[model samples]
Target: MKTLILFVALVGYTQALSYSDVLEEEWNRFQLDYTKFYQTEDEALLRRLIFVDNKRRIDKHNRRFMAGKESYEMGVNQFTDLLPKEFQSQMLSSLNITEAEGLIDFRYTAPRDVDPPSSIDWRARGAVTPVMDQGENCGSCWAFATTGTLEGQTFLKTGRLVSLSEQNLIDCSNDAPYYNEGCKGGLELNALMYIMHKGIDTESSYPYRGTQQKCRFNSSNIGASVEAFIGVSGEANLAAATAFHGPVSVRVDSEGMQSYKGGVYNNPNCSDEILDHAMVVVGYGNDKSGGDYWLVKNSWGTTWGENGYIRMSRNRNNQCGIATIAVFPIV
Candidate 1:
């Protein structure tokens, strides 16, 4: 009996060691160091949980890989390993965004020559598209997407790039009827409405805190304004709108987006079930293999996707709900 007990303990120890080795390799590959979360032995259990969670993620990634069906790379990066699910839902969900019942109807007066070229990138056209940014842990993707489209439009109209304030919308947009939740979430449409009714301030005036705060917008410090907004449909309309405007904000079923690394992201699991996350479509192009893709600008910073953006599979009948809830602000 003593020998059997000893043998069981040895097996348990080997399993733990194997898990530790695999966790270390994943951390190294993703350039993470969870040791920073340690201050006490009780707190150190977080490391164990993280290690376990990373293993779970690895198993999931491997399954996707083994199926020979992965269109994007999966990694144990910040988004996949750290961000909480409740926070992601709060950040992404604006409460039945696909309803489209109260959507505003506005006539567009854009340049007649709106037919986009084979491909167009507003960043390369001397537009002041700012560098990629992070929203931390707040359910503030709505604010980020709102500010991104605003920044792009400001540059397109004035020929000057200016980083607008997501913090401003996070603080002040609660006044919007549609923006019921402050930090928890807000609709990009409501954000555009706030900008139209009350102009937005710059990032310098109201830096992002990634959380809810009392409204403190300065009217004198307004930086950008949206003259009107337009709803777009299909690949052709979205592409044309992007070329005529700058960036278009769209909501997508991004439940599977965190694990994505690069390539034309087309996960069979992600469907148009609902619109959860808001993003800006900056441009579109076809790959070498003629796979059409939408260049989407994400707010998760530069380390997340192909440098803070994703080339999602486009023209696949609106795969991943890319154009389901799409719109762009007219500056």
Candidate 2:
């Protein structure tokens, strides 16, 4: 009887030890997987795990990865001293700038009626057009976004749409007292200001081969021009957007935008503040679901959003910063 009792106790102890060993192995494996996954910082995987599972573990990892990427890019730019001297001064001054947080509330204003015949439609006026992209791996979004809007406006006004070089703004705009390097973000307003003051040339005159190049200023044939800059207030901007025929520049929170799939994103329940990023507003209308959405064009490749664009909720001032910033009609 004594021997049997001792044997039973030993077996139980061994089984418990084996179970602990298995658990420890799993924990280590999970740690390894997480490190490798986040090291690459794949946006698609982060979106899938974050939205589908609401996995807090993965969310923490994603934020770390994004921070790492931002830090790495900033460090590289700093080491190389890639930005123009003038832009660095401006970026340092604007470091504390932040956009409004939470949902914005306002009334929609009816759009102004501009006669179609009297105005030139840039979209219809051109046979060939320049392709635009979001400045990924670089903080040159302001340069790209502003150049795109001007390109369209130039086409409408002059009936000749020329591909304006972004490299000019990247290198030359630094001459302004407030400009920053391509690593730190900048405002589209400043970009336009640079064009009006310095005079921007055509892409052929100053091509964007990427990387920092010598400053080339050709004041003689600065192809395009800006008529005016119209600032919109609150949610009312949506109504103002529909009336315009050409592109309008606006800000948006693009942090999680990398993973957005097809859906009418309406979550008044989120607690965290959204990050502000700029994008072009191309068109707006109601969709098949009988819900109104704004047709927005993004800089990320077409595979990212609804073919490089998204139809955000028009009624709510979320998704893109629809209620914030100003939209202008290039007269």
lDDT of 2 by residue, 1-331 (tens): 9999999999997877864464445444544543323345475354333333323333444464456421110111111211223223322112212422111122234455642221222334461244455333455656666776676666656777688777777777765553645535666666676676676888778876445557887877576665555555454454454344466666655433344444443334321234345566555666555266665665544444555566666666453455465444354
lDDT (C-alpha, whole model) for all candidates:
0.73, 0.51
Question: What is the clash count for each candidate, in the order shown?
Answer: 1, 5
* lDDT for each residue of candidate 1 in 140-175, tens digit (9 for 90 to 100): 777878888878888877878888888888888886
Minimum summed lDDT over a 10-residue window in model 2 is located at 70-79
Error of 1 at 54 (Å): 3.9
Candidate number with greatest lDDT:
1
- List the candidates' TM-scores in order: 0.82, 0.59
Candidate 1 runs further than 4 Å off: 1-20, 25-47, 50-56, 59-68, 82-87, 98-101, 107-115, 131-134, 176-178
